[model samples]
Target: MNEQERMTRRRFLKACGLGLAGLSLSGYMTYLFGGTSVKDVLKSTLGGTGADGFRALENFRINSVEPTPNVQLADYRLTVDGLVANPVTWSFAELKHALTEVEQVSDFHCVEGWGIKNVRWTGVKMRELIQQVRPMQTATHVTFYSLGGVYTESLSLAEAMEEETLLAYGIYGKDLPAPQGYPLRAIIPRMFGYKGAKWVYRIEFTDHQHLGYWERYGYNVDGVTAR
Candidate 1:
C-alpha cells in the first residue's frame, strides 16, 4: 500500500476501535493526527482505573490486528546479517534449540489504545540470539524483518538488550495465531506494541537505526508509554 493508504488504514482502525466502545473517533483523531495522546483520553474513559489509565489487558481473546506471513515450517530460516562480525543463518528447527526456551508473563500494549496483561510468551531471548552470533562492536542497531517480506522494525542495540525482550513462538500455551505473527513474534514489555513486531525472520545489525513500516508512516518512532 502507498503511504496515504497506510495512514488511512491506521485511522480507520483507530476509529473502529473507538467506535466499537462508544468512544469518540474525532477525539482519537486528535490523538493520532494531532498532539493529543490516547493515554490522556483513556484516563477519562477508564475513570482512573489503573496507573496512567492503561487498561490492564486481562483476556486471551485474540485482540491483535497484525497480519501473518506465509511460511512453511520446513522452509523457515532466519538470517542474522549486515554489520555483524559473524553472520549466522538458523532454520526453524535450530531456533527451537538456540536457547533454553523460557516462558514469561508480560503486559502487551498496542498503540491504537488496547492492551493485554500477564501475557505468557515462549521463545528465545533476542540477546541470546545476538550473543550466539556476536555482533561486531561497530553494530549500533538491529533491524527485524518479517516473513511477509513487508513488515519491518528497528531498535538500537541498547534497546534490544533490555530485559524481557523475546522472540516468541507461543502465546498462552499455544502456537502464536497466524494473524498475530505466528512462527515468531516480538514481545517487548514496556514499549507500545508496534515496536514489538511480529513474523520477524531476519535480524540485520547496522550502525544506523532505520524506521519501520509504521514509523515511516507517522507512528511514534519511540513507542514508549507511561509505566
Candidate 2:
C-alpha cells in the first residue's frame, strides 16, 4: 500500500482500538489472528444488556475516529446507476414507500472475531432494488458507497441478489443510531461485517469488481466469514 493509504488504515485501526494495522495478518490470516485480540478487548469491556440481545456496545464494532456525518433525511438521496437499464435516485421517504421492507434476524460476524447474534434488521432486499434498476447483461458486480464518501464495498451480482442482502434502515425495532450509520447500511449476512458498507448512499452496477476500502489494505476482497 502507498504511504497515504497506510496512514489512513492506521487511523482506522486506531479508531477501532484494534491496534492490528502493523500486523501482517492480510487476507484470511486477518481473521485467524486478529479475531483473538478483538475478542479479548470485547470481553474486557462488557456491561449491561442492550437491545437485540447485545451487551453494551456490542451491537456493532465502534469506529470512534470519524465523527458521524449529519445526514438530513429531507435531503438524503440514494442513487442507483452504472451498468443498468434504469438509473434512478430516491429520497429516503420515497425509497421506503416504494420498496417493500422486510425484517430478518441474522448473526453479524466480524473478521476481528467479535460478533453479534440474532440482530433484528429491517430494510429492503437488495434483489428488489436490482429488479427495479435492471442491471445490464454486462453488469456482474454491485458496489455500495457510503455517504461519508470514503468507504465503498462490492459484491458479485449473484451475491447482491442473495436473500440475506439487505439495505437496512432500522435495527432492534428503532431507527439506526448515528454510530450505526443512521439512515442506511448494507447487511450481507454471509460475509464479515466489513462487507456491509454503512451509511450507504449509492449503488452502482459494474462490469468489474470494485475493491473496497479494506480490500486495498489486503483484507479479503470477498470478506466472507471464515466460519
Candidate 3:
C-alpha cells in the first residue's frame, strides 16, 4: 500500500481499537508480508473514508440502551415556552395529528464525520411551529432539549425556517427508532447532525445566540462541513 493509504488504515484501526495482531494471520500475512493491497482491507474495515466513516463511528454504539416504550401518550408532553407570546404544551398524539406532515429527502451531515442515507423524514415544519408560537421580532435562535439530556441543538431563525427542515417523527416509512430519536427529532438539511436534536422534549425561543451542549465544547454550532 502507498504511504497515505497505510496512514489512513492505521488511523482507522486505531479508532476501531484493533491492533495488527488482531487481524487474521492470512489477511495480515498476505497484506503485510506478501504486500497484498491494503485498499481492500481499508475499505472493508473503515467502510468509507473521511466524514462518512467518522459519522458512522460516532453513531456506532453496540450496547446502547433502547428507549422505554411510550405507553401513555396523554402523559407525554412537549413544552414550547420561553420568549414566545403563545407558549404552549402539546401531547404526543396532539403533535402527531395536529400538525401538517411534510416529507423531506435530504443529506444528514455531521461535523464529527459521516452523513445520513438520503433520509425521508415526515413531521411538522419548523416554520409552522414558529407561526404557532409567533416568535417576537427580537428572537434570533431556538434551543432544543431532548428527553434524556443526551442530545441538544440550536439553529438561527433563518436556518430553522428552511422548507427542508422538520421536527421528524418518522424515518423512511416507520416510526423513528429509539436510539435514533424516538417521539420526535429535528431534521436540518443544511446543518450537521449536531443541529438535528433527537428525542426533543422542549423548545425555547431566545433573542441571543446560545451555545448548545456540543457547541460548548468545540463542535461548530452551524455545522457546515468542509467540502
Each prediction's whole-model lDDT (CA):
0.75, 0.82, 0.72
Question: How many clashes in each structure?
Answer: 2, 1, 2
Pick the lDDT winner: 2
Query: What TM-score quantifies how close candidate 2 is to the native fold?
Result: 0.76
Indicate the residue-level lDDT of 173 in model 2.
Answer: 80
Q: For residues 1-227, what per-residue lDDT tens digits would candidate 3 score against the true structure?
A: 99999999989979666655566665655443222135534554655455543333334332222344453445768899878899889998888666788887776665645444556677889899989888888889998988876556788888888888799988765677777677888888888777778778899999977787777878777777433
Query: Between candidates 2 and 3, which one is better according to lDDT?
Result: 2
How many angstroms is residue 4 displaced in model 2 relative to the true structure, after the best TM-score fit?
A: 64
State which candidate has the highest TM-score. Answer: 2
- What are the TM-scores, per candidate, against the unseen true structure? 0.70, 0.76, 0.68
- The reply for model 1, stretches above 4 Å from the true place, is 1-67, 225-227
Candidate 2 C-alpha lDDT tens digits along 1-227: 89999999989878766535435334345343223355534453452235424442343677523568899999999999999999999999999987999999998888877776678889999999999999999999999998878888999999999999999999888888888887999999889888888888999999999998888878888787342
Can you list the residue pairs that collide in candidate 2? 35-112
Give the clashing residue pairs of candidate 3, or none: 51-114, 55-113
RMSD of each: 13.9, 13.3, 10.7
